[model samples]
Target: MKPLKRILRILKTISLYALLLIYLSPFFFVLINSFKSRREIISNPFGLPDVWSLDNFVTAFQKMDFVSAFVNSLVITFFSVIGIAVFSSMTAYIFVRTDWRFNKVMFFVMVAAMLIPFQAIMIPLVQIYGGLNLLNSRWILIYMYLGFGSSFAVFLYHGFIKAIPLELEEAAMIDGCSRIQVFFRIVFPLLKPTTLTLIILNVLWIWNDFLLPSLVLISSSNRTLPLTTFYFHGTYTSDYGLLMAALMLTILPVIIFYAFLQKYIIKGVMEGAVKA
Candidate 1:
């Protein structure tokens, strides 16, 4: 029995390692090709670079207008995430604390909305906003993100908020705090873990989103990193080395952000699950 268990454990470890390698292979391919020349990338993509160079990165940065794109991405993601977190948390709090039939119905509607895919509404949504001349603006993009992102955020916050004791809010109100004060001071602070989880999740989604931005933002000056990366592809040809480098630059910030806050994701989910 001991011998059999040891063999099984070894097989499991090997399987896990193999899966990790499979997931990381694409990223490694991009990283390797990012350092090579265009000709080398085209001729021998799998081979190591003859001479590691920063030229592709420099050219990609210049051509993509990296700084402007980065700032646009940052602003859209920041505002969208903030709006989602704030509005969703407040909505969840109202649903949890109040016994209103309207609140219950609205909550159910929002949850049902999540079941509808963005692809289903994509064309109509774009056309409606475009007809209004509301397209191609960062503020409009952020507003749309908030509308789309809130449902899931509210769902997460709803479960977590239910786990918080109503007694805490009652105590604050009894001690001369207004309803607003009670929530801001007592309930909101306790929502830290859940809020952090939502922020990171929404940041990753909004930052990497391409299709929505492409439909909404028509101007080059307002493009995000994902949109800017499209510059590497032309009608008849593409710059593979520059494209890889651009991809690396576009993904690096979110990768770093995720790496640092990854632990909180599980922590928040676990806490909400256990408490809910």
Candidate 2:
């Protein structure tokens, strides 16, 4: 029995490492190829660069309009994430604390909204917002993100909020704190872990989102990193080195962000699951 268990454990470890390598293979390919020349990439895509160079990075940066696109992505992601966190937490708090029928119905409807894919409503969304000339505005895109992202944010917050005790809020109220004061001081601080997780999740989503921004941000100046990369690749036409470099640049910020917040994300998930 011991021998069998030891063999099984070894097999499981090997399987996990193999899967990890498979998942990371594409990124490794892209990183290596980014340093190669266009001809080298085409000839031997998987091999090491004959000479490592920043040539691709320089070209990709210029071609992709890195500064403008990065600023646009940052702005959109910042406002969208802040809005989602604030509104979702408040909405979730209301749903958890209130026993009203309306709150229950609304929460149910929002949860149902999660099952509806963005692709299903995007056409009508474009038409309606375009008719109002709301298309092509970054702020409008942020507002749309707020609406779309809120349901899941609310769902997560609702579960986490339920775990919090009402006695805490009651104590604050007894000490001359109004409802708003109690929420801001007593409850909101306790939501930090979950909020951090939500911020990371929504920031990643908004930063990487291509479709919605493509539809809304018509002007070149207002384009996000992903959109800029699309146009940059089109203009360069089969410059795989530049393409890979641009891709790496686009994903770098989010990777750094995740590295910092990954532990909080895991903690939030565990706490929420245990509470539920």
Q: Which candidate number has the best lDDT?
A: 2
Please state the error at residue 245 of candidate 2 in Å: 1.5
Off by over 4 Å in 1: 1-8, 265-276
lDDT of 2 by residue, 1-276 (tens): 699999999999999999999998998998999999999999999889999999999988887889999999989999999999998999999899999999999999999998999999999999999999989999999999999999998999999899998998998888999887888898999999888778766776788899999999999999999999898878877989999999888877777876987887667566655543
Error of 2 at 101 (Å): 3.3
Candidate 1 structure quality by residue, lDDT tens digits, 1-276: 699999999999999999999999999999999999788998998988999898888988888889999999999999999999988898899998999999999999999998999999899999899999999999999999989998988899899888887787888888999988888888888999888877766776788898999999999999998888775455214678888888888878878876887787667556545543
Q: Scored by Cα lDDT, where does model 2 land?
A: 0.89
Scanning candidate 1 in windows of ten residues, the lowest lDDT window is: 230-239
| Cα-based lDDT at residue 151, candidate 1 | 90
